[model samples]
Target: MRWSETCLSEQLGIDPGKELQQLYLRILRQDPALTLDPPVLATEPAAVKHNLPAQVTSFNGRDWEMIEVREMITEHRLVTLVGGGGVGKSRLAVEVAQNVLDDFPDGVWLVELPPLVQPGITAQSLAKALSLGEHPIVPLEEVIEDRLKRKKRS
Candidate 1:
């Protein structure tokens, strides 16, 4: 069935421009299975750490009990700074992310999926927010991997 459609489209002499449209179609059909070689990730080293925002106030000993948590975040590759409401966890994450934004040359991106009420659609909301319109048909993991790789590069 697909072969016939391709043949028909070919025989019709309907050329949607041999350059741009063909390239666009190639983009639409890009897949590892279709092509022997796939695109490679950027090999640039990580960016240097940048200075944090001056607006961030330092944590007082008694004020932020999450000092250990903050230290863990600073030390670990990935830290989940979790806490109760109004417990300064978000504030801490913002500060930490700001402090290390330069280290992540891609930049500190805060994806606020507040309007995304459904957990199932969180990825879609994030993709839209990030302006990553490609690969909508692919799984969320693939989208995230692609975005993270691109972010790491630039």
Candidate 2:
């Protein structure tokens, strides 16, 4: 479900893109009063489990900081790393994921949500990121968790 289909926009005739930009800023401000009509995304646990790959980087102190963060991710942890736009959070995450992709024998997945507006679309993005079968109806997170559980069991 895209944000365009939400009642808030249809009833109020609001442009969701602008609203999301506003909401993103509001979230950055840590504004407690900011209310989302459909409610903003609920934090979800990181799906990372088991061994991680060695991160080998030539960066200096700042790069080291990002590596430290990537190393510190705990099980079921929901980490929201806030930094200036274009400050390389995505880059760091990708670097870490690439380094550790080999640890996940099933496969490593990178889900990009920048284009997503509706909260429901997150799971879809996850499913797509993992390259699941076309038009699967199961929720993305559930499918991911199920696969991880199977891997752990094995």
Candidate 3:
């Protein structure tokens, strides 16, 4: 089952009975040999999780920009959103991430880099964002890459 459907049924407590019934009826009409069982709700543990900050204020406007950013992220491996302070760049990114959360099987993480004083510790910051501890033998970048590769495969 898709995570969105699972979330809708489990997290939000929105009963999927109507939708399921429609599908079941349609399937039964098409084929009598098929059997449909009630779906079991289970919370699959996320491979990667983040404590994304909640949006306190309502979002306004920027529908087109959000769509463009979402498309860019879907098509490209990397995307950067640049804008001046208080221009809603961070808010926009968070919204986009939330919108596409179900698309990423592993998970979506938000790494806030504003507190970092030096550029050299960027990798460390990323590691912290991913909740990765220091490895005795493997390098941080290699470890991150391997984990990402595994997630992509799944």
Which candidate leads the pack in TM-score?
Answer: 3
Question: What lDDT does each candidate get?
Answer: 0.57, 0.57, 0.73
Instruction: List where candidate 1 sits over 4 angstroms from the true fold.
Output: 1-58, 61-80, 113-117
Q: Is candidate 1 or candidate 3 better by TM-score?
A: 3
Output the TM-score of candidate 1.
0.44
Candidate 1 global lDDT:
0.57
| TM-score of each model, in listed order | 0.44, 0.45, 0.58
- Count steric clashes of candidate 3: 0
The TM-score, computed over Cα atoms with residue i paired to residue i, of candidate 2 is: 0.45
C-alpha RMSD (angstroms) for model 3: 15.4
The regions of model 3 sitting more than 4 angstroms off are: 1-48, 115-117
After superposition on all C-alphas, the RMSD of every candidate to the true structure, in Å, is 14.4, 21.9, 15.4
Looking at candidate 1, what is the lDDT of residue 131? 62
Q: Taking the tens digit of each residue's C-alpha lDDT, what string does model 2 give over 19-138? A: 777776788797979754685667877665423335565534466766676565434222345577788666666666566555555544445566457776766665565555544686
Among residues 3 or more apart in sequence or in different chains, the pairs in candidate 2 whose N, CA or C atoms overlap within 3 Å are none
Top model number, lDDT: 3
Q: Tell me the tens digit of each residue's lDDT in model 1 across 1-154.
A: 3454566579985444556455656767873444665667788675544323455467544435455654664454345544566776656666656655656665655443454467757666556645666565888757766775655522
Ranking by TM-score: 3, 2, 1
Candidate 1 backbone collisions, by pair: none
